[model samples]
Target chain A: MIILIDKKGFVLSLDAAVAVVLVTIILMGSAFFFLKTNETFIVNMQMLRVGSDITAVLQADGTLDTLDPLQIKSGIEEILPISYNMRMLINSTASSSIIIVETESAQTNKKFIVAGKRFFYAVQGGNAYPSAVTYEVWPK
Target chain B: MKKAVFFTLSLTMFAFIVLSLSFIFAGNAATDDARFMELASINRIYDLDTSLQNSFSKIFSLDSEMTYTASTTEAIFQQKIPFNFTRLNNSFNNLRNFAIYNDKNVQVGLLPNNVSLRVSQAGIVNWQNISKNITEFMRTNSTPKSYSFIIDFFEINITSCSSSSASGNFSFSVAATGGNGTSCNQTLSINPLQDASVEISLGTKSLTVLFSNYSASVNARDNKVALTSRINYADTGVKPKIFLESKINITVPGLIAKKYGDLRIA
Candidate 1:
């Protein structure tokens, strides 16, 4: 018969082990969040760039005096491959606007108009911050 | 064994959390991008519209002033001359589109296409080939005391590409009456002149009117009187008015009593 010693009175030092486990979990969580945020930022940046480029192209085309629709489309296509969803609306006064993804796609909607010499904002989405870049079409 | 189990569970949770966060961030980024794109597109359209409106306004203003000057000149000519002088000068540098029609609804001369008003008339002489017919009439006429003339003017059309192109016609008609009318058994030389009323229907938004009146005595002993009127309409549907008056004394000696008068409106 062996006499049982009260080794239960001896406290186990779990500091190193617990510290490692905690560090691992924290590292994993942080990495996951960082990667996600980075990806989102990149995608947003790309989309913004594309949209701005398209706007610039349309303005540069000036008024749609040329009866050649293909010319205009080709000109825009040179800069960005327009999806089937992309559409352009021209007004009787020789102004135009392009509408892209639907509200369902991004949970947001926007509209703009050309007033006098400056670009005026008509609408903004819930998630969008105001832009600082103001655009204008010079007199012909 | 328990420790191993707990560690394994923690690892799985961490992996799941990371995966979910990544998805959320990605989705957010995509959403933001779309918003930015839409806003930019709108701004472009707005800018274009503003520019077009401003240009149109300036052009319209200049056109109104030019029309006034042309009418005033025509009125003065009719008063001084015995013959009916229909002023057909409607072409202006700022007008993109213009048209002219007579009281009988007949289109006389179209500018920038059928005729170039810029060089059509050299003083009182017709320079363009199209006006050769009118010039011949003026040369052959010895007695201008009994005659009628109609003049029409219009502006050129400008394109969206900022190129000047041909467009719809805007016209004004001037009718001058000069003849011998018997009143109370007395033969009186009467020269009745009518100024063409200028009407411009640019679109549903704007309308412009120009009118003038002038009268003179055939005896060349009386004073000549002329009146010019201009009106411009804007968004409030109210019309703005401008009027000018001029008087001239004639000293040409003639025994025959001759009277001249004219009225015009569109």
Candidate 2:
């Protein structure tokens, strides 16, 4: 009788052990899920800040005068604590259409005309992703 | 009894495993969030750069004629033939540390309300501090020229600001090249070959500009001067980044017609 009782007690304990193991597995799974969600949220926030700065700098007309390559570099350096690298490029593009303006002369049969007003400035930059910024300007 | 002891031990191990896993997952989540935020900020900067470029293009298209007219008495005109030294001085004041080099390579430090007695056809202008003489020269001798204008922008790193050192130590440069007149044929070329260049460096980031050159050629009998231009940029920086470049081109149809006549009547 005593042996039987001991045997029954051991089986019950075994069942309890199995139940505890199951609970631990569930806890670990939950923790992983929480970690992943939080990470996604933080990344999104960083991206937002970067976008804001870019917009602010570009929208500033007075800032354009200050768009010296060196100054821009400095600005990036100022913001480097945030872990971002910045670059800018302004190039003239051959993609242009000629415009011809003609005027009939009042004094003679000759007409006055102007031509060759085709040219563009290409502005491009690279970040985590490659992007191009183009500024087109005609002759003065 | 042995069976009971074994079962108890197994349950304890299981509980420990569960707790450890949970902690690991939680820690990972936080790290992931940080990484994501960093990437987002970088993207935002790029987007702004793209938008700025688009805006500049629109403006350039609307004002393809890069001409700005000012009377002899106009502030810009009264400054001089080769440059409006006064305006240049003012512009430098707005920048943290400004410097200019003329064809002669003479460095002229521009100071607020300051004037210099040195007289020359072309020389450098440096704006390290404000001075009285520099101001006078800008008002009296500065002149606007008919051809190209070289504008430089510098960025100074503000390491620290106190009574001892008010300004930052580091700087980077960006230049805008604009041209006018009959002799400015190469300056206005639209091809990539005709563009000029400026060197820029910020910390570890660096790049070079190959300005687009645009050119237009008419009959020798025609009075209109030929024009050409080229513009180009390349990334020599550590990471890919975006930036904005804005330029305005104005063409005075009436003025060109009066000066060159049929030469521009293409």
Candidate 3:
């Protein structure tokens, strides 16, 4: 009825144009899928950022120097969001490194775990000592 | 047939373009992950440096170290700086897989002995006791201007009295005497040091002399940024997450002074 076909039964008009356009669409769709953001990695980075910020807050407020695990624990809980959980470990040259502070049942296995740490001087037994604070965070 | 060939060729070109774009996107994603891990390691390295500096400064304020002459002061400061470095190194060795820390990752001064105090942040304890003593001594004396208090190596002399106001503002001047005087001549920066921070109070039943940087002569806030920080990093058997064992001699910039001349109100 009005097919645009060449003498050799080849499509040379609208059909060819439509085929080219369809191929372009498929390629574009695949490109988008390929470029879909790696959100898991981004979330991990964000979790690490939150962990670092909490430690920074602790150090800034001077609660870290007290070496009182209770004060440090409360300090972390006050700043951490409700949707996430945290666990803090303190390591000092004066003492063995251990989990000094934590949120409610912060299990690292609940989700993908992101960890962060901080370092500073804290006085214990009348001596200023070097100490490291490590924190692990996960979504609840 | 020519048209078929042309359409096929066009499709192939589109496929190539899309594949190239995907690779570029993937490459960006990888570098970003590496960059974040790098950033975390660098932060740890910086904390290691500050711990060493603070330890050095705190030693000067120790009751044990205060009795030394200038030579002994230098000796003690030099000898004591190594105390924290090894402990910190071993503690940090636990995190090497993160590739942000390793053995001897952060160094202050020189390595293998010769660790000098890059920035001294010694603080005098029993401050409340000393300040109260000074105020009480000055209040009862007929000529208050002649009053001076010496704590082992440091002397606080009160003179050139304009007037004695309430206990809200104060100032200090320090000059090193009878030694090499390596760093005592530099204008003091008192710690608990949030810039332009802290109120030094001296009080009695009726009189108080306070020192705040708000006054003209107290220790002005100064911040030091160390750019020569070299961090050694190595990680192997991981692709794109980190590089092969390579030395990352990065010149860390904007490292703020951790602690110096701490004035604790004990």
Error of 3 at B130 (Å): 25
DockQ of the two-chain complex in candidate 2:
0.20
**2 or 3: which has the higher DockQ?**
2
- Compared with the true structure, all predictions reach lDDT values of 0.28, 0.31, 0.41
* lDDT (tens digit, per residue) of candidate 2 on A1-140: 78867678666776776777677667757766885587546544543444355424543432323334455445544543344333333221221322111111122333211111111122334101112222211111
lDDT (Cα, tens digit) per residue for candidate 1, span B1-266: 46655665666566566556656655664566455445444433333333323322233232322232222122112112111122222322211121111011111221221121210111111112222121111211111222222222122111111111122222222221112321111111232234222222222311212222221111111112121221111122222122111111111122121112111111
> Which candidate gets the maximum DockQ versus the true structure?
2
1 versus 3: better lDDT goes to: 3
Q: DockQ, in order, for the candidates?
A: 0.05, 0.20, 0.11
What tens digits encode model 3's per-residue C-alpha lDDT throughout B1-266? 77777866676676567556656665666666566566655545544443333333343334222222121111111111112334433322322222234223443322222111211121111111221122111111111111112111112222222232233212222332221222122122332111222222111111122333221222111211111111111221222111111122223335432322221111
Question: Who wins the TM-score comparison?
Answer: 3
Q: Which ranges in model 1 have alpha carbons more than 4 Å from their true place?
A: A1-19, A63-69, A81-86, A94-140, B1-266
Residue-level lDDT of model 3, residues A15-132, one tens digit each, is: 5556657656765665555345456556666787788778777876778878778998899889888877888888765565564677865464547767755565676666565566
Model 2 TM-score (2 dp):
0.28
